[model samples]
Target: MRRVPESAEAARTLVRTALAAWGQRDLIEDAALVITALVSNAVHHARLESIRVIVTRPSEKCVRLGVVDRSRNIPYLRTDSDGDNTRGRGLLLVDALTDRWGTDRYRWGKQVWGELTCD
Candidate 1:
């Protein structure tokens, strides 16, 4: 996907459609939220040429979604709770909603993934 603000909505629509097909629509909201964060990070932070959003059903009990970008930068939760900070809170939302989340590094790029319990 192109690195743009609209990419987040595109990812959410893709996730919603895929989860609906898999009968896991219950995870749509959280999954959409996580993907938004993932795509935003890839676009704003990594500034990559392209980004890939993958939503997979590893099992009937879980749904895993990831965003891959052409950067090796690892994402960390920012603890800056200054009430005025407008950025750096995406991962915190992800952590609260997902069962587990982390990053994967590859030679060419990195993937940040989050899993949701659907069952």
Candidate 2:
């Protein structure tokens, strides 16, 4: 789904709808958090031009969620941060919550994606 939500709530709703189809109610919060953070990062750093959230069921037990932004910059996990730093923890949270995650560059931009397994 491609959306240009002016706020985080709209992004959360998109994630909720995707997860609901898989009957993975328990993963909603984590998924929403991941989506929100990615979208926020795109908005803040990538200029928030356009966002694409793709939800794919690669198999019966695995669902992949991808957030594609207009920027081609790939996200990295920043560990060396000041204790007082308020930003730069989104990907870390995604790493902790999802089964697997990574990024790939596309023709238009780059996609930061995570996979959740309903095992």
TM-score of each: 0.95, 0.85
- Top candidate on TM-score is 1
lDDT of each: 0.89, 0.77
Candidate 2, 1-119: lDDT as tens digits: 33444646777787799778778888888888877777766766664456776777899888777777778788898878769887888888888888989998987688888888875
Over 1-119, each residue of candidate 1 has an lDDT whose tens digit, in order, gives 89888899999999999999998878888889999988888888775678999999898789999999888888998777969776788899889989999999999889999999986
Off by over 4 Å in 2: 1-6
- What's the C-alpha lDDT at position 118 in model 2? 70
Candidate 1's C-alpha runs over 4 A off are none
Please give the lDDT score for candidate 1: 0.89
